[model samples]
Target: MDSKAEQQLASIANISNQKERTTSYLALLSTLFSSQPPSKDALITLGRHFVTSMSMAMVVGRRVLGSYVIALCAGTSMDTTGTASITLDDEGSGENQQFMQAGINAFKSSEGEEVRRDVVEGVLAGGNLSGWCEEQTTVLRHLYAHLLQLEEDWLGAAKALMQIPLEGGSRLISDEEKLAVYIKIVRLLLECGEWGQAQTYFSRASLLIHVTKDKETNLSYKLSQARLFDFSARFNEAAQKYHEVSFDSAIAEEDRLQMLKAAVTTSILAPAGPQRSRILATLNRDDRVHSSLPPSLSTMLRKMLLEYIVRQEEVKEFEAGLEDHQRATVEGGGTVLERAVREHNVGACGKVYDNISFEALGNILNLDAENAENTARRMIEQCRLRAWIDQPLHLLYFESRSSHDTDAEAQGTAGGLGIENKEKEVEPRLWSERWDDRIRETSIKVEALAEQIQQKGLIPPIPA
Candidate 1:
């Protein structure tokens, strides 16, 4: 092809008409590949030209043409029967080495294996006797040897095989082979966390489902895709795919349930408000919704609930909200005196009387007060110890008397003993201080008990 023909071909490809553009490109390729006794130099030059043109086409939004060119270069066979094979003649000549080099060069230039194979096959099958000359055969065989070398250098042929663009060419592997490759590449990409690249392969695999009528395979691919999307925080997309697969009758109930769970889990992590509500609502409506899930899943759900609803911070808010209600109740409002009076009225007066005469005296008074005061203290101590060892008592005490000297002078003058005035004067302040101290200590005990119960996940018994 001359510069003038190349220019004309470029102009034809640039035509506004889509059909004409495609036709012109197709014609150009056919003419170029169809040349009888294809010159080795011409074929190599053509391969290079096509690669450049196709790359440019890709850049310029001519994906179809770019893909086609790729297909033409790769040795892709269209027979879906899976019988297509490539054979190289090893004549042990320089021409074979050149052919092989050209083939390898084509492979290196394009990412699409289908195109490279197609071009090689086309060149070989065209029966160009001159192109098949001994030297060219040896060169072609050498190229195959290089490809084999690449296969060995890499862990497997997988890396080399993956480099081939399989989508663009008309002649390609069967759906099954393609699916296998798709799965392999997808797994690799997923392992590498290349979700976006994995998605492209997934999408391509999904297309195979339509072509091959393999509902199960398709669902599996979609499920994998959903998982990837979910991993990437694309919840909506993930949920949609999951829902689609889950609803399909071809899927098993167990599989559907798994998918629904995934969808629900993702939905929960979605932004709060209407979207979440909608997802939950749909989840509730699922026909497979069971009264209980598996133990492991149920355990996970319970943990999530605890974290979301029963964490210490949430517990604090709950407790704060309950404080007002608690305060309005008798348990919260009644003072120790009030409670004691109520207990006495309820025929529990013995406990209160014993506690007051025994415990209070022993703890509050000193032995130097007097023999009588000491005796009172000893009696109080005995009563308190007995009560504590036996059972809990709700009785409480509060001092009603004022300790002011002026008040005492006005109210007392009782009892014949002169010591009575002093005794009376000292008792009120002692009782008052003792009462306050007891109340503070009791409050501390109650709060500590409550905290213990809270930590143990048990409800504390209400006070009687």
Candidate 2:
């Protein structure tokens, strides 16, 4: 830093006003990096100072420290993915690298993975932990977990986070902070597509968030669950959850925008049905989408959605702009949009055409007669489409009623649910049905436990 800059920092640090100190620090960071970027050595020095200073206060008084560490972690993006990022983001790579190195220098040189661990171990060996309060210990546990991430032991870190102890029945964190921790773990699991573990942590997060009654955390946690559902191939469920989350006032504009986009994307991939139609319809009339999204992106989403719900026609111009991955249908055997269109067209025919020729079906699904016939067979077999393809007559017979009642009854659905119907089903069981079953099961178990208490004369029972 320039001499003048150092003098400014000195003068600002001397100020006793909390707000002024904060403003000064913000200004300092901007000034320091706004000019030519600082060297690693300069960042290391600054980082060591910050780490030492913060540590002194935390250890001397044993503050909760989560806020300080969390702020530091956020600046470095360590909390974003539950791992220390090896490379810096492109847009602000230089400035971010400086910030990240500062975080690193607090415990270790930029090159040493064992930096935080060593500092923490030293603190523990010195009996520093013995004096720390639960919240303070919580901070150390979080720090140690993050340090494990720098070593690429992210799964281990997640396990450690889950195991952060309680002295009695109380937890070390506030309700909101506890929810945040669970969200962090869930996101980290999502990074590596660990759907099972992500689901587990998200389930816990959903429970923790209920006690606070904060709409923002509630909506954000729903977004996390939606992402997990998306990965689990529960597209329609994810789409519905994303749609709900998008409309919540508590979500930030950026996240809400992304949530809306995801809603449109997943809605297309959801099995063709009235549920899909409802999602698309909701998105179509929402003026917020048009006003909030970029013109090109809004147009693309609209075009893709229209292609599924109403027009399953040729989309060459639209397809031209997509990248190879977008064009490729790796998830369900066709490009995502393509699968949506094909599936929609297949389901739409039951409503419009009771008996259509293979050639006509092909035109609607954007396939050749032979290919369309094959697709119809696959869908019928999978119980996604309620129809039969007659090769001899080169025709498809769309049933007027339940196909299962016919000579060639449709088998159970793709996931062993009931047959596809005229209005169409979303998934194996309606989400509501699943919840009802869970609640009913819980009620029965509770009743059984109550009976056991009364029958066995187990400890004093509650009033009737």
Candidate 3:
């Protein structure tokens, strides 16, 4: 501190009455900043001593004086330096702790909210987090987060909430509290479309979800999980979770219907496979699809369930309801919905044709021959479609099976092109067996030919 500031602090520290000392202290601070502002280091020095003196005054039952002193020091520093960062040596750590606690305590009073808000904002904005006690840090961050949320800055609010140490803080945290904070963080990040980061917090929440009995916590956890899956393009899992959450009695009817609709949409958008097909069957079987959902979604669900090709207009209507992430292009050159639709169409074609030319398949799928071939190849490789490509003939030949067997095969292991079980050992066919069958067939034909000749008497009696 400068000579003048030090003298002022020393002089105020000696006053007998808390109110008189506090009044003198505030006047001195006002005078210092009336014309020329103090240097950063000088202002920090004054702030530390100011906190110490005010806290001591409060020990004598002058809390109101201490609160004003706390507010004045923080405001003066911010006005002078446009920042209120204060650094303390190891010896002065306690003073720093006292300073933060005083600000928090003052914030709890009826008339100190606005002033204490400035103090919290200044401290969080520029002060080192290590200098504050854990309880103080948690309280201040929660306050700051609430303020950020009021501004609708979701990303900022999430970031602020993340800084509140959930583990190993001086304040004992309950599992319920931890879960609630994690859920709130997840919800905020999701609002800002930060799914990647949201997943990290959701994973943390999931670990504690079963341990807590809070219904609101469980509901939030489930909803966040579904949204995370949906954003990550795991639409099948997303659909299942959404459908499950939609049945929660705690949710209102309108909200439940919204979630059910989401389930239907995601189920349709999921990659066409046995897993997706099963979900589709479940949804189609549900009376709610016909009663609760719109006609367009219900119709699309029926067409997909029965393996009928979906129309472009139907896809367009569905696309309008998709989230940004759902509409995002995948590794290949199309939106997620496009890929799902194309794969579904390929599966549908397997139902209708034993074999189809690549050009014809492309025309039906509204894609070029190569693209259609590629799409079919992917599903076949994934064991989602029971089909093979005759590369030399540019034809797609589907392996026909009974509907029961088809369902079983779709549910089978994803080993190969839904053709052979590559993982299991198989005996090779012997060339000798093949030759014996061929020779027998030839002999029968030869005998028949001889009989015909004898009947016509065309062969002379050469055998006799």
Per-candidate TM-scores read 0.30, 0.51, 0.69
For each candidate, the alpha-carbon lDDT, in order, equals: 0.43, 0.57, 0.70
Instruction: Supply candidate 2's per-residue lDDT for 95.
Output: 47
lDDT of 2 by residue, 1-464 (tens): 23554466558657776555654554555444332223333332333334334323322222112222332343332443222112222433344445544444443434333434554433323332332344444555576667777677777667667655532534334566667778877876776667698898788777777776666556667777888878876778887898888887776788788888777667656665455655565566578768876564456455444433345333444455443333445543567667766776776677667889989888877678888887777777666665655567898877566444331122212322333435444233354764586599999999999888889987676689
Model 1 lDDT tens row, 191-225: 54566777787777776655555655566677778
Predicted structure with the largest lDDT when compared to the true one? 3
| lDDT at residue 129 of model 3 (Cα atoms) | 45
Clashing pairs in 2: 329-334, 329-335
Q: Which numbered prediction scores highest in TM-score against the true structure?
A: 3
Please state every model's RMSD to the true fold in angstroms.
27.2, 21.3, 9.8
lDDT of 3: 0.70
- Residue-wise lDDT of candidate 3 within 205-319, one digit each (tens)? 8888888777877788889999999999899999999999989999999999999999999999998876786677677667888997889999988888778999899999988
Worst 10 residues of 2 by lDDT: 407-416
Off by over 4 Å in 1: 1-161, 164-180, 203-210, 247-256, 292-464
| TM-score, predicted candidate 2 vs. hidden true structure | 0.51
Candidate 2's C-alpha lDDT? 0.57
